[model samples]
Target: MNIKTEFSDKTLTAIIEGDIDHHTAKGIRETIDLAVEEKNPSALTLDFGNVQFMDSSGIGLIMGRYRLMKLLNGNLELVNLPEHINRLISLSGLFSLDIIKNKGCEQIETRE
Candidate 1:
Protein backbone atom coordinates (compact mmCIF):
# COMPACT_ATOMS: atom_id res chain seq x y z
CA MET A 1 0.00 0.00 0.00
CA ASN A 2 1.05 3.60 -0.54
CA ILE A 3 0.33 6.25 2.09
CA LYS A 4 0.29 9.93 1.29
CA THR A 5 0.17 12.11 4.38
CA GLU A 6 -0.82 15.74 4.80
CA PHE A 7 -0.80 17.76 7.99
CA SER A 8 -2.54 20.90 9.12
CA ASP A 9 -1.52 21.97 12.57
CA LYS A 10 -2.35 19.10 14.92
CA THR A 11 -4.44 17.19 12.36
CA LEU A 12 -3.03 14.63 9.96
CA THR A 13 -4.69 13.04 6.96
CA ALA A 14 -3.45 9.85 5.36
CA ILE A 15 -4.59 8.89 1.89
CA ILE A 16 -4.12 5.18 1.52
CA GLU A 17 -3.93 3.35 -1.79
CA GLY A 18 -3.66 -0.28 -2.86
CA ASP A 19 -4.46 -3.36 -0.82
CA ILE A 20 -4.29 -3.33 2.96
CA ASP A 21 -3.54 -6.86 4.05
CA HIS A 22 -0.79 -8.64 5.92
CA HIS A 23 1.67 -7.86 3.14
CA THR A 24 1.29 -4.10 3.40
CA ALA A 25 -0.12 -3.43 6.85
CA LYS A 26 3.29 -3.32 8.54
CA GLY A 27 4.68 -0.67 6.22
CA ILE A 28 1.53 1.38 6.48
CA ARG A 29 1.59 1.14 10.23
CA GLU A 30 5.22 2.24 10.49
CA THR A 31 4.92 5.09 8.01
CA ILE A 32 1.71 6.48 9.48
CA ASP A 33 2.99 6.20 13.04
CA LEU A 34 6.19 8.04 12.21
CA ALA A 35 4.30 10.78 10.44
CA VAL A 36 1.83 11.19 13.32
CA GLU A 37 4.64 11.45 15.85
CA GLU A 38 6.67 13.86 13.73
CA LYS A 39 3.63 16.02 13.20
CA ASN A 40 2.25 15.54 16.71
CA PRO A 41 -1.22 15.44 15.24
CA SER A 42 -4.17 15.65 17.62
CA ALA A 43 -6.45 14.07 15.02
CA LEU A 44 -6.05 11.54 12.21
CA THR A 45 -8.15 11.12 9.09
CA LEU A 46 -7.85 8.05 6.90
CA ASP A 47 -8.83 8.24 3.25
CA PHE A 48 -9.45 4.93 1.52
CA GLY A 49 -10.60 6.12 -1.85
CA ASN A 50 -8.03 4.11 -3.79
CA VAL A 51 -7.93 1.03 -1.67
CA GLN A 52 -9.06 -2.09 -3.51
CA PHE A 53 -8.82 -4.81 -0.94
CA MET A 54 -8.44 -5.29 2.79
CA ASP A 55 -8.58 -8.05 5.33
CA SER A 56 -8.54 -8.52 9.08
CA SER A 57 -5.18 -6.82 9.23
CA GLY A 58 -6.86 -3.64 8.10
CA ILE A 59 -9.21 -3.85 11.06
CA GLY A 60 -6.25 -4.31 13.36
CA LEU A 61 -4.55 -1.26 11.89
CA ILE A 62 -7.60 0.93 12.40
CA MET A 63 -8.08 -0.30 15.95
CA GLY A 64 -4.46 0.36 16.75
CA ARG A 65 -4.65 3.91 15.45
CA TYR A 66 -7.88 4.49 17.36
CA ARG A 67 -6.15 3.48 20.55
CA LEU A 68 -3.23 5.75 19.84
CA MET A 69 -5.46 8.70 19.09
CA LYS A 70 -7.47 8.14 22.26
CA LEU A 71 -4.29 8.11 24.33
CA LEU A 72 -3.35 11.47 22.84
CA ASN A 73 -6.79 12.86 23.59
CA GLY A 74 -7.39 13.11 19.88
CA ASN A 75 -9.70 11.38 17.39
CA LEU A 76 -9.80 9.22 14.28
CA GLU A 77 -11.94 9.49 11.17
CA LEU A 78 -12.36 7.51 7.95
CA VAL A 79 -13.54 8.59 4.53
CA ASN A 80 -14.07 7.40 0.95
CA LEU A 81 -14.95 3.93 2.03
CA PRO A 82 -16.56 1.76 -0.61
CA GLU A 83 -19.57 -0.38 0.16
CA HIS A 84 -17.55 -3.47 0.88
CA ILE A 85 -15.15 -1.58 3.06
CA ASN A 86 -18.02 0.04 4.87
CA ARG A 87 -19.48 -3.36 5.50
CA LEU A 88 -16.24 -4.60 6.97
CA ILE A 89 -15.86 -1.56 9.15
CA SER A 90 -19.40 -1.76 10.38
CA LEU A 91 -19.12 -5.45 11.06
CA SER A 92 -15.99 -4.69 12.98
CA GLY A 93 -17.93 -2.02 14.87
CA LEU A 94 -15.63 0.81 13.85
CA PHE A 95 -18.59 3.04 13.05
CA SER A 96 -18.81 4.04 16.72
CA LEU A 97 -15.55 5.91 16.11
CA ASP A 98 -15.89 7.93 12.92
CA ILE A 99 -16.88 7.38 9.30
CA ILE A 100 -17.40 10.07 6.71
CA LYS A 101 -17.72 10.30 2.94
CA ASN A 102 -15.14 11.98 0.74
CA LYS A 103 -16.12 15.26 -0.83
CA GLY A 104 -13.17 16.90 -2.47
CA CYS A 105 -10.93 17.59 0.49
CA GLU A 106 -13.70 18.52 2.84
CA GLN A 107 -12.77 19.11 6.45
CA ILE A 108 -14.60 16.42 8.38
CA GLU A 109 -15.45 16.85 12.01
CA THR A 110 -13.33 14.97 14.52
CA ARG A 111 -15.02 12.07 16.31
CA GLU A 112 -14.58 10.92 19.86
Candidate 2:
Protein backbone atom coordinates (compact mmCIF):
# COMPACT_ATOMS: atom_id res chain seq x y z
CA MET A 1 0.00 0.00 0.00
CA ASN A 2 1.01 3.59 -0.61
CA ILE A 3 -0.26 6.65 1.23
CA LYS A 4 0.35 10.23 0.23
CA THR A 5 -0.72 13.22 2.27
CA GLU A 6 -1.35 16.85 1.54
CA PHE A 7 -2.11 19.54 4.11
CA SER A 8 -3.74 22.86 3.46
CA ASP A 9 -6.52 25.14 4.68
CA LYS A 10 -6.70 23.24 7.94
CA THR A 11 -7.46 20.03 6.13
CA LEU A 12 -5.36 16.94 5.57
CA THR A 13 -5.99 14.71 2.59
CA ALA A 14 -4.55 11.24 2.28
CA ILE A 15 -4.60 9.52 -1.06
CA ILE A 16 -4.43 5.79 -0.44
CA GLU A 17 -3.74 3.31 -3.17
CA GLY A 18 -3.46 -0.50 -3.41
CA ASP A 19 -5.09 -2.99 -1.13
CA ILE A 20 -5.98 -2.36 2.49
CA ASP A 21 -5.59 -5.62 4.29
CA HIS A 22 -4.27 -6.76 7.64
CA HIS A 23 -0.71 -6.38 6.46
CA THR A 24 -1.06 -2.89 5.06
CA ALA A 25 -3.60 -1.23 7.33
CA LYS A 26 -1.25 -0.80 10.25
CA GLY A 27 1.41 0.95 8.23
CA ILE A 28 -1.18 3.19 6.64
CA ARG A 29 -2.58 4.06 10.04
CA GLU A 30 0.82 4.96 11.43
CA THR A 31 1.65 7.14 8.46
CA ILE A 32 -1.66 8.98 8.63
CA ASP A 33 -1.48 9.43 12.36
CA LEU A 34 1.94 11.01 12.08
CA ALA A 35 0.64 13.49 9.55
CA VAL A 36 -2.42 14.27 11.66
CA GLU A 37 -0.36 15.05 14.69
CA GLU A 38 1.96 17.29 12.73
CA LYS A 39 -0.71 19.10 10.71
CA ASN A 40 -3.58 19.09 13.22
CA PRO A 41 -6.02 19.70 10.41
CA SER A 42 -9.62 20.42 11.20
CA ALA A 43 -10.69 17.97 8.54
CA LEU A 44 -9.22 14.77 7.12
CA THR A 45 -10.23 13.33 3.79
CA LEU A 46 -9.33 9.72 2.92
CA ASP A 47 -9.42 9.31 -0.80
CA PHE A 48 -9.95 5.67 -1.75
CA GLY A 49 -10.22 6.14 -5.45
CA ASN A 50 -7.13 4.08 -6.17
CA VAL A 51 -7.76 1.39 -3.64
CA GLN A 52 -8.47 -1.92 -5.35
CA PHE A 53 -9.09 -4.33 -2.53
CA MET A 54 -10.07 -4.07 1.10
CA ASP A 55 -11.02 -6.41 3.92
CA SER A 56 -12.15 -5.97 7.51
CA SER A 57 -8.86 -4.28 8.22
CA GLY A 58 -10.11 -1.40 6.14
CA ILE A 59 -12.99 -1.00 8.57
CA GLY A 60 -10.56 -1.03 11.43
CA LEU A 61 -8.47 1.60 9.74
CA ILE A 62 -11.47 3.85 9.25
CA MET A 63 -12.70 3.38 12.79
CA GLY A 64 -9.31 4.14 14.26
CA ARG A 65 -8.93 7.27 12.17
CA TYR A 66 -12.43 8.41 13.06
CA ARG A 67 -11.66 8.11 16.73
CA LEU A 68 -8.37 9.89 16.31
CA MET A 69 -9.97 12.78 14.46
CA LYS A 70 -12.73 13.14 17.02
CA LEU A 71 -10.24 13.13 19.83
CA LEU A 72 -8.44 15.99 18.14
CA ASN A 73 -11.64 17.95 17.64
CA GLY A 74 -11.48 17.28 13.95
CA ASN A 75 -13.62 15.46 11.39
CA LEU A 76 -13.09 12.59 8.97
CA GLU A 77 -14.36 12.14 5.45
CA LEU A 78 -14.19 9.18 3.03
CA VAL A 79 -14.40 9.88 -0.65
CA ASN A 80 -13.91 8.53 -4.18
CA LEU A 81 -14.90 5.10 -3.02
CA PRO A 82 -15.43 2.55 -5.72
CA GLU A 83 -18.57 0.43 -5.71
CA HIS A 84 -16.98 -2.53 -3.95
CA ILE A 85 -15.44 -0.45 -1.21
CA ASN A 86 -18.71 1.44 -0.74
CA ARG A 87 -20.52 -1.84 -0.33
CA LEU A 88 -17.97 -2.98 2.21
CA ILE A 89 -18.44 0.18 4.26
CA SER A 90 -22.20 -0.22 4.11
CA LEU A 91 -22.15 -3.90 4.94
CA SER A 92 -19.72 -3.30 7.76
CA GLY A 93 -22.33 -0.91 9.25
CA LEU A 94 -19.97 2.05 9.39
CA PHE A 95 -22.51 4.28 7.71
CA SER A 96 -24.88 3.76 10.62
CA LEU A 97 -22.31 5.35 12.88
CA ASP A 98 -22.25 8.42 10.62
CA ILE A 99 -18.54 8.05 10.08
CA ILE A 100 -18.90 9.41 6.63
CA LYS A 101 -19.51 13.13 6.85
CA ASN A 102 -20.12 13.96 3.18
CA LYS A 103 -21.61 11.04 1.34
CA GLY A 104 -22.89 13.17 -1.50
CA CYS A 105 -19.50 13.88 -2.95
CA GLU A 106 -18.49 11.03 -5.23
CA GLN A 107 -14.90 12.28 -5.29
CA ILE A 108 -12.78 14.82 -3.50
CA GLU A 109 -11.56 17.42 -5.95
CA THR A 110 -8.06 18.71 -5.40
CA ARG A 111 -6.65 22.05 -6.43
CA GLU A 112 -3.71 22.02 -8.77
Candidate 3:
Protein backbone atom coordinates (compact mmCIF):
# COMPACT_ATOMS: atom_id res chain seq x y z
CA MET A 1 0.00 0.00 0.00
CA ASN A 2 1.02 3.58 -0.59
CA ILE A 3 0.19 6.29 1.90
CA LYS A 4 1.31 9.79 1.02
CA THR A 5 0.86 12.31 3.78
CA GLU A 6 0.71 16.07 3.62
CA PHE A 7 0.50 18.57 6.41
CA SER A 8 -0.70 22.13 6.27
CA ASP A 9 -2.45 24.56 8.55
CA LYS A 10 -2.27 21.98 11.34
CA THR A 11 -4.20 19.43 9.33
CA LEU A 12 -2.74 16.23 7.95
CA THR A 13 -4.10 14.56 4.82
CA ALA A 14 -3.18 11.02 3.91
CA ILE A 15 -3.81 9.83 0.37
CA ILE A 16 -4.00 6.06 0.52
CA GLU A 17 -3.66 3.74 -2.44
CA GLY A 18 -3.83 -0.01 -2.77
CA ASP A 19 -5.73 -2.70 -0.92
CA ILE A 20 -6.17 -2.16 2.80
CA ASP A 21 -6.23 -5.78 3.89
CA HIS A 22 -4.49 -7.54 6.74
CA HIS A 23 -1.15 -7.42 4.97
CA THR A 24 -1.09 -3.68 4.36
CA ALA A 25 -3.20 -2.20 7.15
CA LYS A 26 -0.44 -2.34 9.74
CA GLY A 27 2.08 -0.64 7.50
CA ILE A 28 -0.40 2.00 6.49
CA ARG A 29 -1.39 2.59 10.09
CA GLU A 30 2.25 2.85 11.17
CA THR A 31 3.08 5.29 8.44
CA ILE A 32 0.08 7.47 9.23
CA ASP A 33 0.67 7.33 12.97
CA LEU A 34 4.28 8.31 12.47
CA ALA A 35 3.18 11.30 10.48
CA VAL A 36 0.63 12.16 13.13
CA GLU A 37 3.35 12.26 15.75
CA GLU A 38 5.65 14.35 13.61
CA LYS A 39 3.01 16.83 12.47
CA ASN A 40 0.78 16.96 15.52
CA PRO A 41 -2.02 18.17 13.34
CA SER A 42 -5.34 19.33 14.71
CA ALA A 43 -7.13 17.23 12.16
CA LEU A 44 -6.24 14.17 10.10
CA THR A 45 -8.07 13.25 6.92
CA LEU A 46 -7.79 9.83 5.34
CA ASP A 47 -8.45 9.88 1.60
CA PHE A 48 -9.33 6.53 0.15
CA GLY A 49 -10.04 7.47 -3.43
CA ASN A 50 -7.44 5.15 -4.86
CA VAL A 51 -8.23 2.12 -2.80
CA GLN A 52 -9.45 -0.70 -5.02
CA PHE A 53 -10.03 -3.24 -2.29
CA MET A 54 -10.33 -3.48 1.46
CA ASP A 55 -11.50 -5.75 4.26
CA SER A 56 -12.26 -5.62 7.98
CA SER A 57 -8.70 -4.43 8.41
CA GLY A 58 -9.71 -1.15 6.83
CA ILE A 59 -12.34 -0.65 9.48
CA GLY A 60 -9.77 -1.48 12.12
CA LEU A 61 -7.41 1.06 10.63
CA ILE A 62 -10.03 3.77 10.88
CA MET A 63 -11.02 2.85 14.40
CA GLY A 64 -7.42 2.85 15.54
CA ARG A 65 -6.79 6.21 13.98
CA TYR A 66 -9.91 7.60 15.58
CA ARG A 67 -8.63 6.57 18.97
CA LEU A 68 -5.24 8.02 18.27
CA MET A 69 -6.67 11.33 17.24
CA LYS A 70 -8.85 11.42 20.30
CA LEU A 71 -5.90 10.77 22.54
CA LEU A 72 -4.02 13.56 20.85
CA ASN A 73 -6.97 15.93 21.31
CA GLY A 74 -7.35 16.13 17.56
CA ASN A 75 -10.04 14.96 15.14
CA LEU A 76 -10.17 12.27 12.49
CA GLU A 77 -12.05 12.56 9.21
CA LEU A 78 -12.55 10.30 6.23
CA VAL A 79 -12.98 11.19 2.58
CA ASN A 80 -12.95 9.78 -0.92
CA LEU A 81 -14.19 6.42 0.22
CA PRO A 82 -15.02 3.94 -2.49
CA GLU A 83 -18.58 2.60 -2.40
CA HIS A 84 -17.60 -0.78 -1.07
CA ILE A 85 -15.44 0.68 1.62
CA ASN A 86 -18.21 3.04 2.64
CA ARG A 87 -20.65 0.19 2.92
CA LEU A 88 -18.22 -1.80 4.99
CA ILE A 89 -17.67 0.98 7.47
CA SER A 90 -21.37 1.75 7.67
CA LEU A 91 -22.23 -1.87 8.32
CA SER A 92 -19.63 -2.03 11.06
CA GLY A 93 -21.92 0.28 13.06
CA LEU A 94 -19.28 2.91 13.53
CA PHE A 95 -21.52 5.87 14.26
CA SER A 96 -18.65 8.32 13.98
CA LEU A 97 -18.23 7.32 10.38
CA ASP A 98 -21.34 9.22 9.38
CA ILE A 99 -20.33 12.33 11.26
CA ILE A 100 -17.25 12.89 9.19
CA LYS A 101 -17.93 15.97 7.07
CA ASN A 102 -16.61 14.38 3.93
CA LYS A 103 -17.92 10.88 4.35
CA GLY A 104 -20.17 9.03 1.82
CA CYS A 105 -18.57 10.39 -1.29
CA GLU A 106 -18.36 7.47 -3.66
CA GLN A 107 -15.22 9.07 -4.98
CA ILE A 108 -13.57 12.40 -4.50
CA GLU A 109 -11.29 13.91 -7.09
CA THR A 110 -7.62 14.11 -6.24
CA ARG A 111 -4.92 16.29 -7.75
CA GLU A 112 -2.87 13.27 -8.63
lDDT of 1 by residue, 9-92 (tens): 778999999999999999999989999888888889988888989988999999999898888888888778766777777678
Kindly list the per-residue Cα lDDT of model 3 for residues 1-112, writing each as its tens digit.
4889999999999999989999999899999999999999999999988899999999899999999999998888888777787678767777555535545575433333
Candidate 3 regions exceeding 4 Å error are 97-99, 107-112
lDDT, residue 90, candidate 3: 69
Candidate 2, residues 71-93, lDDT tens digits: the string is 99888988888777777787777
Residue 84 shift from truth in candidate 2, angstroms? 0.5
Question: What does the lDDT read for residue 2 in candidate 3?
Answer: 85
The candidate scoring highest on lDDT is 2
Model 2 worst lDDT run, 10 consecutive residues: 102-111
Q: List ranges where model 2 is wrong by over 4 Å.
A: 101-112
